[model samples]
Target: MAKNTSGRGQRELRVKVKTARGRKLSSTLWLERQLNDPYVQRAKREGYRGRAAFKIEEIDDKFRFLVPGARVVDLGCAPGGWLQIAVPRINALGEKSGKRMGRIIGIDLQEVEPVPGAEIHVLDFLEDDADDKVKGWLDGKADLVMSDMAAASSGHKQTDHLRIMALCEAAAYFAFDVLEEGGTFVAKVLAGGAEGDLQKVLKQKFTKVAYMKPGASRSDSSEKFVVATGFRG
Candidate 1:
């Protein structure tokens, strides 16, 4: 953040990126946006891995899914920001006296520095029997299964949309297998016409399927989250 007293009494100014020889214009623009984003600053001060943590915080604030004693599985849980948000809300630390302690398991293809109070695993969730493995770790089935995964962007808007929708669909299917009856499933997705089929499938498996763009998500981003609850088993 910057200040410009020359204009008004004391106007707050957005941090601007100075062009550097080695940096691409796109990279510079992204850096400047990050510097100006309040959520990013809050994440740094609050000790969360990234601003993405607040997206889940806002969602759970409305839906109240991260209740005490809930068992949660995070797919592609790299960096573990969502796990950090879930830990305290779900009471995973047993610090909330008289509340049931929750359990959180996070899985990714690559290992992550463990979030305290979360079980981190390096298994790929899409491979055969992956659901069984997660269930074993949970000692049965999970109460919630969530993902914040997105495929590498191909730069083409339509292609990127289809790719992320595929990932969200896969995560939903995995949730179907691992979640106990009446559980919840949440995952990030890009808003585009290609999501219809995925929405149809989720509606079949879960009693309520809704979409939301949390306030923490950038207004310019097409990203949104699908929150399906009351899994029918």
Candidate 2:
């Protein structure tokens, strides 16, 4: 059994992990952090798929974009956490009386186990005519197009940053093609020098563009979310 290292109580308890012989130090550290993360515990208790759900929840709560009847597209929605959050907030189940039902469409390179009220597809959003396919599934334009996609890490920080930026730019273009006028685009991005170009493009197309690092994000991480609302086109 693991012991609490930060003093035990309802509010202050931290789990400590001892390194195992076969585990790399980095892996051990990650496991320890997961065990100690309050968001992880909260997610489990609240029946969410993972901690990343809170990041999107916080963003949507502040921005007021995931309303009832809004159509949403979630890019690279793996492990189905974001989908779980979206279903209830968007009233996809028609459980919210008097509110119109919403739609959720998610796509990824790999197959995701179905999320109850969401339509999850296995497709790379960057491929040819992918935007058309997504629109076909939704049957119309989306009110919001969001992405939590990050490229596979190359063990080189700068290289990884550029790759993710490229992915974000691609998602932005897809949003441009399929979003309704006054729509929204939300995506995760790393804080690096190369993001200026992406920001420029977003500013041109959106009435308001804001950057946020949600409280659920780690303090040491450079990841931030770019929320461009009030789409001009």
Candidate 3:
């Protein structure tokens, strides 16, 4: 169990479970892992919207992507975690006189609480109308398009992987349509690698396409990020 040490004095509590209660082994393991994860505790102390913020932070640090004043679009940005990290970076640049003001737009089917300096919309990215809605909000081409979208797990690994791939492909298509020439796209994908067809398309459209798994992501997790930069459009 992780202790809350922020001077709030929140004690860690453990609940007893009976061995014969029929709880699944996977569920028990998941709960135990969450209880012990230091990042989870740190996220709580820092008031981040989610622990996923650290994943983006680690990736951005390594890649030197996500520059200040970049026009960034965050797909599937529920709970506004990524936006929370991005907004501050952009704002810091604007603090200097004559720097270009940055714009960040976020979309999710789930309603997100407003984050200062970001425009958010609630709509399913898979719907037929989603593209039009996002275009309208964008006002102009984006410098960066990023998605952390993940399909709900069905407990079947193959099915879940396919669903996530479908989402990634859809997001990639949208990125191709909306990103400016020389722009970038980043998305979350499963361990099987992006669908081959999608990889082929990204290679044709962008100067660089690569897959990265940040250190903040759990070793046991299959999630990785696909980054396509220097869009030809």
Candidate 4:
């Protein structure tokens, strides 16, 4: 039923989903892909909300920005997988003796189920006064401002790309206003031609801007993450 990639020479098993009377072909294909995805299986075994958790986990592992005591703000943090990973990594629970306690704030347009050690609010990050409100929640600037938000797909590929790029750009500016100097900004963006301006702005505002597609991300997906560190603000 599932592929095992644990051993070096093990054969991978691919699961096939047959379309049913009520299910669309696209839905069946998606289901099959999810069923065979190693990351999805790993998430279930590890008790994570979803596979997207590994994307942030791998990225933070390479960058090491989610250190103990770091104050993090997650934009559009729904389902709370990122929040769950951030809690322990950042020492938000104060369970790590001798480590400074960390804090995290999450905001989404819809109400999300609670994740221990994270403060989640039902608010849209794109609102005009959202940055100010976030600062109020954090009691100061944040050491990290990360986003995993993507616009609702319109089925038009180019239009979807533009929409995500715009959302990423807005998140960048919001980070500029609320991130601490020498902090980090991370967000997901679809690979498309319209990201030039977004990259340019991040370069101007951050000491280093790096792009990566974590191993947990689906290979066929165009999604990539932008990690901008050392915020000028």
Ranking by TM-score: 1, 2, 4, 3
Q: Measured by TM-score, how close is model 3 to the native structure?
A: 0.85
Task: State each model's CA lDDT, in order.
Answer: 0.94, 0.94, 0.83, 0.94
Which residue runs does candidate 4 get wrong by more than 4 Å? 1-13
Which ranges of candidate 3 are over 4 A from the true structure? 1-25, 96-98
My TM-score estimates for the predictions, one after another, are 0.95, 0.94, 0.85, 0.94
Query: What range of 10 consecutive residues in model 1 has the weakest lDDT sum?
Result: 3-12
TM-score attained by model 1:
0.95
Tens digit per residue, CA lDDT, model 1, 165-199: 99998998899899999999999999889999998
| Pairs in steric clash, model 4 | none
Each candidate's number of clashing pairs is: 0, 0, 0, 0
| Candidates in order: C-alpha RMSD to true structure | 2.9, 3.5, 5.0, 3.8
Flag regions of model 1 displaced more than 4 Å: 1-11
* lDDT tens digits by residue: candidate 4, 109-155: 99999999999999888789998999999999999999999999999
